[model samples]
Target chain A: MEAIKDKKNLQVVINAGWCKSCGICIDLCPKGALGRDNRDKAVWQYPDKCIRCGLCELRCPDLAITLQEAEEEE
Target chain B: MPVKRYLRQRFFPQLWCAGCGHGQIMASLIRAIEELGLQKNNVVVVSGIGCSSRMPGYLDFHTLHTLHGRALAFATGVKMGRPELNVIVPMGDGDASAIGGNHLIHAARRNINITAIVMNNNIYGMTGGQSSPTTPVAAKSTTAPLGNIDPAFDLVELAKGAGASFVARSTTYHSKEMQNMFVKAINHKGFSFVEVLTQCPTYYGRKNEGVSPTEMMKKFATTTTSIGSPKKKENPELIERGVFVDQERTEYASSYCEMINQMRKQK
Candidate 1:
């Protein structure tokens, strides 16, 4: 179970170092895939809910979020 | 290539205040360059002194951080010196319209092959929230303690009046639209001017009733409409955002070369 969860985490990566906790991504997200962590940074709280729509990635002003391509696993 | 490849990773956590729209503009620009498959070496990003001017430093492309309001001037020189290279100038509202207003008009009049992206944040973010030429009437700023009485310059009209071949406008809320506009402007052969209505949340927002960046972006989405939308007919006051002018013209660099070639033939 832990291995599967770790593998799924690679789908949407967020760089906390670059993130400024602006909340643009969370507010603009269509799927509500992102939520604020304890530190007020964005995190993929519900990875299953994400459709990989890339809106969060596109709308992130900080360039902290990157939606990995699904084909990369092949 | 990925958009990350075009960025200088060392500059992460940019100097802009949280939710400042300039970062979104930069992101759109990088995505546009990537979509166009432009060579990094062939591109030059130039900027004048302001919050928006800091963009060139973050990008990995050939960049020039020039004097205040003189980005277009320096970009003109770069374009003329190497006609094949793509030159992009990102400027702040004050940097473009107030101090560099003359250069802006002249650059457009010359029909030079350069892309100018004016990140219009209404106030001078770098200078402690002073009113700029594009600040809306009745908007309060540090300089305008009561309310700004002066009418703002319509940048789209101004660019068209100055003879820019490509003129467009988009707000930060419409990031996708902005990216597409950037692609089109960069592909244009003559002078291309794109005005992006960004937000200076820290200074401009706090001065005017303490509006946050999210609220500012929401206002942009509600107050602006696309060109030729029926809503615009119903409400003329709604600011129209889209490509205003796109036409082929004899580019300045090409015309100069042709003149030189004709003179050489006569000699």
Candidate 2:
């Protein structure tokens, strides 16, 4: 997670405002690609590891974390 | 973002409590429909009064927000009237088992082709945390001053025994399994029932177990086992998850149609 200074392709968008920080997505992430940040918001700790399985996307009750194509080109 | 296509975006910020699992059930239902490539217009979500019943208000579909604990009856009418449409009813524990208990039994007995998702949070969350039919013995609730003394209904067993053609149980923590079950329930031909366990952190958890949402979810993850797992024999406390009953039977609506046709021919 510390190595994820610059996130790349396939970003996980966490609508932190509605999130309960329940960690269902974190536990369901097949690649262990997500973790909660200091703000208790779900963040793609290692986006590179994500396989776009969408387990987190389909299962989140809050609709908090949605898988999206990386928004930024960087 | 894609799932937004199935939601009524104008209804953003649902009224459910922050940690309520209704949102997860909604997401899973949407994903299941998406996976099945179902047309939104062809799907009808019928719900009764309760926190989970509010799902139809947010989802973009032909919906009926009906009386408390009467969703199955209304859904039965809708399905019988238009057999082509997919009718899905979302009910809370009290809504399904307590007030509408007779309807639940009759619906299963008739084997009407409809899907019923019982969101069993075990407490009447919207009504100030009174113990519901699914509330386990010894659980504390507003109505259960000291502790709940009455035994809870084993919903899966009840559905199976009552003649549901398809029955399954899964929890909010196990999203993948739940989504698969929802899809299966929808696809099944006869009356399909899926009981989804959810965490009522605002009510049940706080008052009964005093655990946070994450803690409650973890408890579900650890306490549950697959229906066929050998661990079930050793740990009787483990709630078994997965499909319990699946059988092919002539659906009531179709049979009624055929009966009418036969009578017309005889005349």
Candidate 3:
């Protein structure tokens, strides 16, 4: 459940277990920030390219993708 | 709590087909329930027989998977028996409009406190892709190989005509809007009917345009417009999406209680 932290202080987490690789999120991502992993699961491939619009999180049919604010480091 | 907590964890990687719109609807529904901050134990998810009816099984709320087209009937009983509980019924197109149409209208007429979501995927995906009541004219299905000649039922109009206190329409492609509509529908005091246009890529898509799930979803975005939008005026063919009716009315359960109290007072 560890989230992938990008430079913009946002966490893009994709639950691999539930992802069916439907490609909806990948196809709908306006910035092409999402890409398929070796297992064909969606991954935050280009973290820098994400605009934090949350479209991927909103339209993910599988409920596998999530965007959250990165926790502040002590 | 996270949205995942509202779901039955053991049911992860749900049985729905990949890219099926039911998952999206389920996700939106869970999000709506979470946003409303409703107690999970106090909510009930009732469903009838169909691919869409399987939603209750994955949700963590008190759920009842009932007989075909009888979800509304069972939901009525549940609401009457436990007036305080929030009853939400998710039904398939055929389940709500065909087999259960009577229950649906009666529930609406009674103005019962319940939220009914009609997942209108057009074709019945579960029973080998047969044409349902909402299947459009000239649409191809297993039961309509030469293209269906039957006209589709206008669910929103039907619910409005049945006197539902709240009525709305949203497609799976409009998940954000759908979630908001779900919130409003649940909060509505009387019977609320929300018809969600979903896609059955396996059956409807293959038999018709042979499009993928993503394409079907994209089509939804293009074909639907907000209620009273100028786009609809220009192109009458576009499906209108949004709340068509939202009026306050005396809820059935409360009225029944008041009647019982009045009789007791006379005694």
DockQ of each: 0.53, 0.46, 0.60
- C-alpha displacement of B113 in model 2, angstroms? 0.2
Candidate 3 lDDT over residue span B1-267, tens digit each? 277889898988888887889999999999899899999999999999999999999999999999999999999999989999999999999999999999999999999999999999999999889999999999989999998999899999999999999999999989889999999999999999999999888888889978778899999999999988999988999999999999999999999989999999999
Give the per-residue lDDT digits (tens) of candidate 2, residues B72-126: 9999999989999999999998999999999999999999999999999999999
Regarding lDDT, does 2 or 3 come out ahead? 3
Superior by TM-score: candidate 1 or candidate 3: 3
Candidate 3 iRMS, in Å?
Answer: 1.5
For candidate 2, the share of real interface contacts preserved is 0.57
Which of the two candidates, 2 or 3, achieves a greater TM-score against the reference? 3
Question: Residue B153 error for model 3, in Å?
Answer: 0.3
**TM-score of each candidate structure, all chains considered together:** 0.94, 0.91, 0.95
TM-score of chain B of each: 0.98, 0.98, 0.98
| Alpha-carbon lDDT, every model | 0.91, 0.89, 0.92
- Best DockQ goes to which candidate? 3
B-chain TM-score of model 3: 0.98
